[model samples]
Target: MRCVVMFSIRMDMRVILFLTLFTGLCIADSKGNLALNGMAVQSSLGHPQGDAQHAVDGNRDSDYKKESCTITKTEFNPWWRVDLGNVYSVSNVTITNRGDCCKDRLRGAQIRIGNKLDNNGNNNELAATILTAPNGTQTFSFESVNGRYVNIFLPGNDEILTLCEVEVFAVIDTPSYICGPRNLALGATAVQSSILSGAGAQRAVDGNRNSLFSLGSCSHTNADRDPWWRVDLGEKYKVTRVSITNIGDGSAARINGAQIRIGNSLENNGNNNELAVTVVSIPLGETKTFQFQPIKGRYVNIVIPGRNEYLHMCEVEVFSD
Candidate 1:
């Protein structure tokens, strides 16, 4: 009886060891990532003229100015990611870095996978890090994870994220739109350095397009150097674009050199804020839109530098995502 019991115990130990080795082998064999082309890719911010879907369009071009991929300004915890649409067992994530410039921008990037929306899906389980050479295409394989969202985030100050393409090998599912938050400027307050009587600052954002604030309905500033008009978007947003409709009848030229600025500060009349673009020309009575590499700000200012011209805007529109 004792000999039979010893033989059974040895057999059980051998089985356990074999199972452990077999599981390891299975994971190793699954290291080849599943291609995730055509997935919905998004970023914390997007340039106004470019869409976020470029990261998953299967294009490997990395030129920042090409508008084919996503790029974010230097900020705290910049992130970009993809949504698999439905939960799937993700095997690995492969990232294609910008081969043209700023290759070092991808180092220390953390690839996270989970379903949570907290912190824009960044507060998830970390899968891997781009610790090796930060250029070209690199693959990071890991244990299979069940998730609908796969995010790549750079944590810390002044982290700028740029992605040419991201491929996820996973059990397949169709993706949904993953754009960032929408326009948050509808009911915010407005202020100007000076306002002409009868044309309050509120006219610019009253959702009225044809109504001219300078034609007795729009806000107007005195003939002071650096005449400025501003709108408070109520809260900070990842500003994607700003649109302004110029009043016709030869009044549009007054806004020709105006600078569109955005930021959290009101210093230097908000001139210290980051400059998005300068208006070269806007056709008479036409609405012109200016886009930036999505910037975060609560205030949007349309100011003519170097005083003596009235800052007239018929309508101002802001959009995110």
Candidate 2:
């Protein structure tokens, strides 16, 4: 696939490339970044943070820290900017401006995306401008604006260009979306690895989501937007092991088949596609447990593709020696 980098600034005035690592979005700050001084706007602007506007009234530059994007500035006043890593096929950007209204710093914020150009009629123009009202949180999605960099012009009506969220996508001919939560660094092992501690003893607590934002398999059947279950081995866990317990879904759920997948199913790495270690054929019953020779892998994703009646699952406790 294509590589996608974020916030990569070029100092030597050379075009850089960004790459996507697996199904994760990683912004590696190796080459650093640059500022885009477009429009007649001031460099970077200030947005009303906790008390920047209040601090201005209180005469406190010490209390306010202004974050700005130099490359992308407003057509009017103090602007905001987003220094992307490399040029991408950007559709649009979603900006959640600060919400406090008492300060006159922010309410309506304007933003745009463009690239720096050399001589000649390169044009270098991407897409149309995106403007927003002085209030509310909205997601503005647009067409593919190809460029090496993007400028998120911040509005400095108040104090600083205060923004809450930022999201950019690589849009070309592909009809796909990027999945994330990027940090899936742990490998896997032969010994048993624990994804959670005492907080998630039987039921599913928090802190077990993979790169896809899907939580690892927990005993709860009513998990958020999840129908299947999975476990990342973290390393290669080789065990002719067995035993699974702490499961029940009342009568509203039932699932079958005890199959396992080694890696991420979204972007196939071709590592463990056909390597399903079938433990047992599970039926829709009160409980199902199995014990057998297990294949060692970086992941062990158990799935119930077909919902027989409802979502059925239990806490699986694997045994090894």
* Maximum-lDDT candidate: 1
In candidate 1, stretches whose alpha carbon ends up further than 4 angstroms from where it belongs are 1-182, 211-216
RMSD to the hidden true structure, all candidates: 20.8, 19.3
Cα lDDT listed for each candidate: 0.67, 0.36
The per-residue C-alpha lDDT of model 1 at residue 193 equals 79
Model 2 alpha-carbon miss at residue 264, Å:
36
lDDT by residue (tens digit), candidate 2, 148-241: 4343443344334444444444552354423232222121222111222222222321111111112223343343232444445444444334
Measured on C-alpha atoms, candidate 2 has an lDDT of 0.36
Worst 10 residues of 1 by lDDT: 1-10
Candidate 1: lDDT over CA atoms? 0.67
- Please write out the lDDT profile of model 1 over residues 70-118, one tens digit for every residue: 7776788888766554355776687888777878888889999887655
